[model samples]
Target: MFTPQGPTLRELAVQALSSVERGYDLLAPKFDHTPFRTPDLLLDPVARALRELGPYETGLDLCCGTGAGLGVLREVCAGRAVGVDFSAGMLEVARAGGPAASYVRGDALALPFGPVFDLVVSFGAFGHFVPGQYPDLFGQVRQVLRPGGQFAFPLPAPPRPGSRGYWAMLGFDGVMRVRNAVWRPPFVMYYRPFRLGDVHRELGRAGFDVALRALPELGERPDGSPRCRLVVATRRS
Candidate 1:
């Protein structure tokens, strides 16, 4: 599911074997060319949702790989837009563009910034974190946000059981589990474990007042439920 500009099959294999940081380092150069990059189709609706919640002064993009989410921050924030990630290679690529934005290389679980942001957003990066790590990750995001500030991101409804997409994700995570059991430096990207109900509890435990907004642009399921939602988690004033 990659373009000619993306990494080769062999390249992907090497990445899977390496540590998560190193894998992204090698993949960073061609990340945008791969299906891994956050698509503009999704970003547009997320930006629309943010505009409704904002007129923010400063914004931060958590796990902002390749700076794709930085544009959303620039669109909503009136002041500075910043991106932070642990991957130096990703930050290098992100920094070259987005003149209105600055980049920082830091762990997501332990961010360096103060509560300086009026808004925080992330895209296509949560799968990298393990389920247990959600609390720490969300805590870090809250720490970097001002009181009454928002931490928002989009979440898609899980694929139906027995669906091709469901099987695809299940297979991927199964392989990952096997790899981590047999290999060094586990690459923790799994799709199925990130359920919305679990996340709502985690965000609440992390001290956020959480709510969900339907993104109708992504369309609806047969049951008329939204396929995607904008998770708006606010730090209490």
Candidate 2:
């Protein structure tokens, strides 16, 4: 669902037909007005979780879109904060509206820094990367962090089978697959590609000791499981 200020149906169609980076560039100005942007409800609880876990010094917001996650980092990270993304248009908007943090346009798979941050956070950007790329992405994040530094993100529980949400996501992914197959410069985003088990394994291989913290603000499922969790992967001390 999009607000009145969000991209029009025609604009969204144009974006879907373009490459992921280009699509995002086209969408950058109205990104915050769409449901696609990471909600503050989710960011607030994750920020609280990180604050409990740290008084971290420097932080990075990987693939920091319009820099929503950077705001979270600013609350917990003491010294400097940085937002890194590959989209120049997105970075431009971020630089204009974000907190007084540095914004860099760079690839997440080959981060330019080394052991420079005490914390790194990402939100809603994983779907852009396929499952196989997780190892390299995690490794890059690990490489950029100091010993005992953390890489954290919030992950909501998967939708239950037979649910409307489940069908909606499935339909969305199916449409995306069809669009990519038929179009050039395929826009890659799949809702179910990044499973938790695979992510945990990839993080382990990337030399991160991973743990999950329940985000109580999202409440619990019918099975008494947390509806959302913060995955905190720490580089070994």
Candidate 3:
């Protein structure tokens, strides 16, 4: 679901044919118009959660595309805020107009900074990483965080069985699997596989004491579970 100003069918097709980095580069200008950009609906509540957890200094946003999470960091962090991503084009857009933060171009798996941040946040970028890469990604985030620091992000509940969303996600992942099997420089985006149970275990193995906070603003499911939750992973102090 994209806006009138968003990339066209042809543009999206072209992007799908390219590598992830190059595709994002081509889409960066119109990214916010697309549904791909992290929305204020999610970011606002995450900001509130961060505020309750901190008066943190020196925040970082991992894979901070257009810098929405960086804005959240600025709201909660009293000091310097930074956004990091591998895409120079995305970083350029991010630096153009966001809550006055600097941008760093670097891979998420090999984050460049040391244990310098008191808080780290990411938004709408997890699908880019596969299950096997979770350890390295978590490790990189841990490496950049102070012992008592937090790594936080909002995660929506999976679509219910037999729902349109459920089928749509399954179909999309299936398509991606086929594409990667036959294509070069695979896109590597899959929505169905990032389960919360597995994620909690992985974060624990990566030395984070994990916790969950429901975002009431996002409402709840029919079965009374939170529609969305904020995963707050803290490095052991």
| Global lDDT of model 1 | 0.91
Candidate 1 backbone collisions, by pair: none
TM-score of each: 0.98, 0.98, 0.98
lDDT of 3 by residue, 141-223 (tens): 99999999999999899999899999999999999999999988899899988999999999999999999999999999999
**Whole-structure CA lDDT of model 2:** 0.93
lDDT of 2 by residue, 181-218 (tens): 88899999999877888999999999999999999999
lDDT value for model 3: 0.92
Candidate 2 pairs with clashing backbones = none
Against the true structure, candidate 1 reaches a TM-score of 0.98
- Error in Å for residue 165 of model 3: 0.8
Clashes of each: 0, 0, 0
**Each model's C-alpha lDDT?**
0.91, 0.93, 0.92
